[model samples]
Target: MLKHALLSLLLLITIHTSNAATPKGPLEILRHSLVQEVFAFGIRPQDTNWFDIEVSTNLTDWSRLATALSTNATAFFVDDSATNAPTRFYRLRIPGTTVAQQQAIWTELRRRTYTIQVERISSSGKYLSADVTVTSGAKHISNVKDPLTGEAVADFDPADFPSIEEIFTKLEAAAQTGIYDLRVWYDPKHGYPTRMIQREISGMNSNVTELRFNLVER
Candidate 1:
């Protein structure tokens, strides 16, 4: 009987030691500061396990940003449409896991995810300020420019050319009306454009010329 008890205690100690080595989930922020939108990417469970992405302004009263099952890589976006507050915090909650597993999950998540925040804009609207809040990331920003004039092109109208330059026109119009295009990019590195936000605006003026994007750092 004493031999059996010693074996059980040894097994318990082994299990505890193993549990202490697990990893946690990572917190990646796509947008932070001077911007209203945000994105978080992390490894979530597949189906059997469950996780919750929580956001808080005060870090006390937490709100659910998203909920998922298992630790599969996933991305989620949130807009401060309801409340325009500064400094938002986010965290992940994983149930039915050892602490070591949580740490490993977090490390992998950080490796794959990066957090960035838009800082400020340049005077001439040629360049913008980007501040890296975290580590392990890369960022680039470019725009459509007149080949001959070397100036940022801001002539195309969304209403006039809805087919060829539909996205650009819509965004330009939005910027003209005091609504900012927080996610429109023409990256020279990638040789393509991508839209991060899609919304309509009214009462735009035609004299609006330059558009600027401030990329946040990770």
Candidate 2:
């Protein structure tokens, strides 16, 4: 099959934008504020495409709030229902770009078995690096070892290093929430993600994942 490896890191940041410059790109939220149970967002669009505004409490399930055509360069959206949920996230997306495109790649990954190396740096500055192996027909990870010492490392929770399938889940969730700018590079041969960077739009947090693969069997 194939061998796969990952190096991931999480960082937190603050993003600051200049009020004097016109924001350009996909639909972007220029500003957001909450007052007296009402949430308001200032948005700007680079193009005239129709967009859907969605809200989610959990990243996985999103509820449509509105659909509007962006004929103008700038607009404001106010959510009166914000008070109903203690925490919520909002995103604006074009009609067909979220789940369908990602599903194709996730499906291919499930059919292959590979060994992977995982290195992670947390926002708190903790770091772990290990090599992992997965078998196509197995229910659990086949192996995890220190790349340097060649010894088993027990300090980690298996959850820390996700399977290819789990990574896809995260990708989908972030896409739905519309909190991050997702950038991905896929292996040309195996059609799997080689690198992914999720940078939060509001500049609050970011995650970067890098995967390197080695084929051991078919």
Candidate 3:
């Protein structure tokens, strides 16, 4: 009887240690903004191809918002353009995973990169809201040609390509010359394009021109 009890105690100790080493999964709140909300959690990479995320004010009740996997997932919320709220909470649930894996996932997310730029139309109408000036790159323009017609492209007036004092001068110039806006926000670490906004110039019409760009580019 004494030997049996001693063996049982040792076995229990081993089991407890093993359990402690495993990870756990639980809800995580990523960000809260007036315009946007973000939440995320971990799911086993093997068990499910995607995660089912639910949001609710009260923990007892929930509503599905998004479904995604460990690598391909975006769990976020946005209020209607007209209506904005103050505070919100989010929750996540996944099977066959522990909370620790979820926490590790969040840590990985923090390493993602972000870039923000705010542009406004200037009070003056003659110039663009923002200007980008560019200098000649290492490769000079041998001869400008219209890619569409295979005809020699006319040189833009000096006013069209202003001198840039900073790195963004080239970008600003490109914007002014009606090249693809090419404005992009990216996460270099993951090689993911987070957001992009572009405008295409249709042609001169009275005083107004038209443009286009993708806000979300995968």
lDDT of 3: 0.30
Q: For candidate 1, lDDT tens digit of each residue in 1-218?
A: 53432232220000112244574423343332222233222332322333444556665786544433322243333433324444455555554232233334434444333333222222334323232333343332234344345466455322221211233345344434433213333322321122233322235621222233222323
lDDT of 2 by residue, 1-218 (tens): 01110001011111222332643334556676666767776676443433456677766787556543333456556667666676677766554233445457556655555665556544445455654566663435444555556676666677767655566676566554443233344444454454443434235654443333333334
Per-model C-alpha RMSD: 21.4, 17.4, 21.4
lDDT of 3 by residue, 29-122 (tens): 3443331222222222221222333444434555544322232132333322212223233443343122233334434543222222212222
TM-score of each: 0.26, 0.43, 0.24
Whole-model lDDT per candidate: 0.34, 0.51, 0.30
Once model 2 is optimally superposed onto the true structure by TM-score, how far is the C-alpha of residue 212 displaced, in angstroms? 5.8
Candidate ordering by lDDT (highest first): 2, 1, 3
Candidate 2: where is the Cα deviation over 4 Å?
Answer: 1-99, 102-112, 135-139, 142-152, 199-218
Residue 129, model 2, lDDT = 60
The model with the greatest TM-score is 2
Error of 2 at 186 (Å): 1.3
Where is the poorest 10-residue window by lDDT in model 3?
Answer: 9-18
